[model samples]
Target chain A: MQSLVIVAHGSHLNPESSAPTYDHADTIRATGAFDEVRTGFWKEEPHFREVLRTVEGDEIYVVPLFVSEGYFTEQVIPRELRLAGWDVSEWDSDGLSADQATLVAEDIDREVHYCGPVGTHRAMTDVIVRRAESVTDDPDVGEGFGLAVVGHGTERNENSAKAIEYHADRIAERDRFDEVKALYMDEDPEVDDLPEHFESDDVVLVPLFIADGYHTQEDIPEDVGLCEDHTEGYDVPETVDGTRIWYAGAVGTEPLMADVVLERAADAGADLGTALDDVRETTRVATGD
Target chain B: MAEPTSDATDEGEASGDAPETDPEAPEIDLPADAFDAVLDALDDRDPGEPLRFEGFSVERDDEGEYVLADGDSSTPLDERDLHEELSERAPAVTDWYAFERVVGEFGPRRAFLRWIEDADGETVATRYAALAEGIERAWGELKITATVTDRGERRYDVRHADDAGVPVDELEAHEDPLDARKLVTYDEKGRYRPLKTAPSLAGGWVFPDLGPRDLYETVETIYPATVANWHREREGGLDVTHWRETMERQSGIYGVVKTWDRGEGHEHVNWVAEACCDDSQCLKRREWEYDDETDLDVDGGDGAFPCREPCSVVVSAARKWTRLESEQPRTYEFDLTPSEKEQVEAIIDAVADGRIDEIREADTKEGANRYRTRFLRAKLFDDEGNLGGVPTEPDEE
Candidate 1:
């Protein structure tokens, strides 16, 4: 039997950090697809290093629960999950042909197969579209609202911007909203300037983040003029300057994210040459979507 | 005289016999409260254990009341209970003043506090720290654990995650699953092997050294640069297959330079490289490239050419340059032999252990240029090679 492990960069304080990743794992397991499914985190307990020892499978599929491909996804995860002492670049099918490979085997490293994060999947577009629609059902709300995919874009890296573009294009294709834009905490499209980009009476801004952290509660809202005005009654007016903007939950906040995780498992399993298509097909059939 | 002698003898015999002490009568006793007092002391000393004691009489009072005392008192005590009492007295949570005093009286210790919510004082729950300052202030109702002074520091397994007992399905669905990268396998020659670490790009992409390129691709993926599509020209470039073909055929520095450019509109490129003139070794040949307005600039000189003048002196200088230029932010991939990697790792360990001086002073054979440079730079030695102003200890402040 094969095992699938999903590694998340969970926050020590935020309960929602690993929510999406684990939720996905649960959904996959509910289908009785894989023999075992487990979780581990970098900032949280049972750390990234010890993840390998927690399972026993002929083949293991590792799917990173990261929003965008960044340093953690690239250098840190690979280094931490590297087979004992073996180099990641040189490992092969027949296995390591060097002293390092021998040392790794002797050390009892787990067989690992990693898949791309769920953020990169084309299917994820469906989640964003549905989220936008639920926020503003104003038949003209799609045109009146500007869709801002708020991401945690850092100044040091441009690769983080790729997810926003991927998501933006996906949402733009639906034609559900007039303006689909990308905004960052550190980089361009400052949250404050979002009000300037649209002529619409109201805007519905969706954050493409995975958890409700400082960005969701404090930064993103503060960036746009969503400050609570004590004088304007308790009602959070869904529109700004006749531009109605509704906030949707993070991508990881979706309850159905578990299905995406199952999709990742299927992808990883396929990569490892143990195709579990029948199990996934069953899910599609059962859901009858 | 004989009659009086018999009477005296009778009296003496009676006195010596002393009423042949009644066999059934008890000997001695004490204040009734004494028994209760001793039992109370035993109960106080050991609350959970069963109490056992015996009383003995030593003498009789004038009224025939016995004088008794507690003797052979052996109260079986529960050590675990006693230890618990000791632990409770020296709680982990204390005022800053008390904490300072504790550390001084005994030694430094790790103290943990269980946070209790306001609704139910008895219930403890983990809360996110809104700011770092909140941790230092007075905590909420807490259940603390701390070792007593003079005993030793106590080790605690801090439960860091939510124990509300999330269902296994919820756990796997949202959490980072276990060993997602199952890297367990070997070949005939015994080398560590990855299932597959190749780049599978969707759109057109081209670069040199596919191995390193793919590795960089993975690196780029792991650490993506979310460059906004400034041009707005949707999809004019070649698909991923053709771009990879271009990278495969390209060779020399110029080959990479020429092949990297995408036409004006929707033109986007990122470069990565590995070597340079800073080491003073790669003077033989310099590697460089120019496709679009890239952020690819050699650190030593304004343009790539002038900086890598004697680049020909260095072996594989052009290739190294290409790799460096191809990286996102002009990153370099030092092609160190495995032994070199091991050496660097050893130096890292030494520095970590506060033994930087050992590496700094080691002979040329043991401490190579790379090791020496890293140590000196890490130690913050001045340009003149003076260590006076440099910090010798690790920085905690």
Candidate 2:
């Protein structure tokens, strides 16, 4: 039987790291499509190889629920999963990129599809804008707000900030807000610099992580002067010095992303015909009961 | 059939305790010249004219103090060798290599299904493949089904494991679940690859069914201590005593993990943590077994730290635990010594009579206390299946 293996960076301490992954897996499973839809985490239950046990037959699909196609998606995951090929080459155009097709040993007759990270999808920019736009009364006609894309940048690798930077630029090009800035948790142009970089007092901070793990929920919020750890779909509010702050939950949890997932699976030979992007209806349609 | 293993003796019918006379122990009574009364009755041959008495097949009471039946009549046989019989019947793991291979490929739970499918019905192999209690303890019921192929080989179908009401065949026909953590970017050029342990991650095998224990949670709870011990061991240069004790309490099994050749190939184990806990990543911590022989190996074999009722910890330890065929298990053998032949027969009588605990509770000797505890670890011999032989499976009520 074919199995869909979702690989996420589960948390040892943060429940948020794995909760969304579990929720999404449960939703996708409700569709009754795969013989098995299981989540394996870097940190959580059914940790990596444990999830592999559920997959017995040749058809295996591994999707990294990562925000970006960086070190983890390319090197760590492929190496750990023993994916057919090295996730070495950088990806282009987001969903279902065949650019990273890794070769397996000759004995491996199984069909394995390694898909792209969630953040690179075209539909993702919409979610980021929506998170920033949701709290405003009239986003199109009224006052334009500043938006900050908070990512886990690195001191060692400049490439670490690529996805966040890319998403921030894409949103900026749209001109929906007065200003857009890319901030990092680890490197230059940090979140602390967001206030100085944007002229507008009403700035919204959007974490571009695949899930609201320790980083998005705890780290980013702490860095942005908020006390609460807000997750996906959460429209929680915190403000400082007349600047109203809106932390849209994780962009990866956007209902639309579920549709993107289906597209990626289909592109990998799952052959789901529909091209619909109604991921928002995932939970409602996926109740399975 | 052979005699089951007890905490002490590895030898069964050849056990050293048989024909000796110990003055310190009381002698058991048997009716003289009863024409092998006890032996013949226990081996009752004719099903058509089967013997039945007192709502149980018997000729005498279980305590064996008196014969309840005469020769052609019903009565208990005297001087029965019930203890040895029980000992012979305890669960003995006969095939270690095949068992490990199955577990290595299918994890613990699925391995149980494979065992049943291979054995036709559950045998000693499948019976203990799961928790000592088996499926009832893991999922509240045992419902593994098998379809016979034209070749007469059994093909197992494991659809009931899920609550979806979907059969295995149907799921396989159209299977693709979404990754809850994030969406997978699919690449047509991707080919299948076996998962290998990342050089930098913690890694091990997965045990299938862990009875009722949730091993992940168990690992989580003990993770801090393991990490701490890892540190202590790294600095303290590996304290075998402390690490062994911690492992025994946390996971009932003991084995080792070390520098391995990933190229040699491992069976179907799913995940491999990059716990690449090299000297750089991990230290002399609690989680690491002492590199006793400094032979951290690739082959995973298991043995007890000390025989105790296993909890989920053994499964955890088994993950990193491996063994090579050359090494032998440390087994102990001794003849049942003085002051206890009386106690042994009395205890057997209590057991066969169905009042073992009562008999045990009534006795105050520290020796009797030790005996009962040891007996508890003993897997009684059962020709049918040892899953039905022990006291730990779950109370039906």
Which candidate number would show the highest lDDT if scored against the true structure? 2
Give lDDT tens digits, candidate 2, residues B255-337. 23322223343321211211222222122112233223222232221110111111122234334544442245653332353
Per-candidate DockQ vs. reference: 0.02, 0.03
- Candidate 1, residue B380: CA error in Å? 40
Highest-TM-score candidate: 2
DockQ of candidate model 1: 0.02
- For model 1, how big is the CA root-mean-square deviation? 29.3
Candidate 1 lDDT by residue in tens digits, B51-94: 22212212223443223222553222243433332233222112
Candidate 1 residue-wise lDDT, A1-289, digit = tens:
6777788877634555665765666666666666667676765433454455445455677777766655555556665565444443442322101111222321125456565566666556655665565555332346556788877676745555777777788788888777888777777776667767776666667787766666776666666667663233222345555555677757666544555555665654433232244333432312122
The ten-residue window of minimal lDDT in model 1 chain B covers: B225-234
Number of clashes in every candidate structure? Answer: 95, 60
lDDT, candidate 1, at B40 = 43
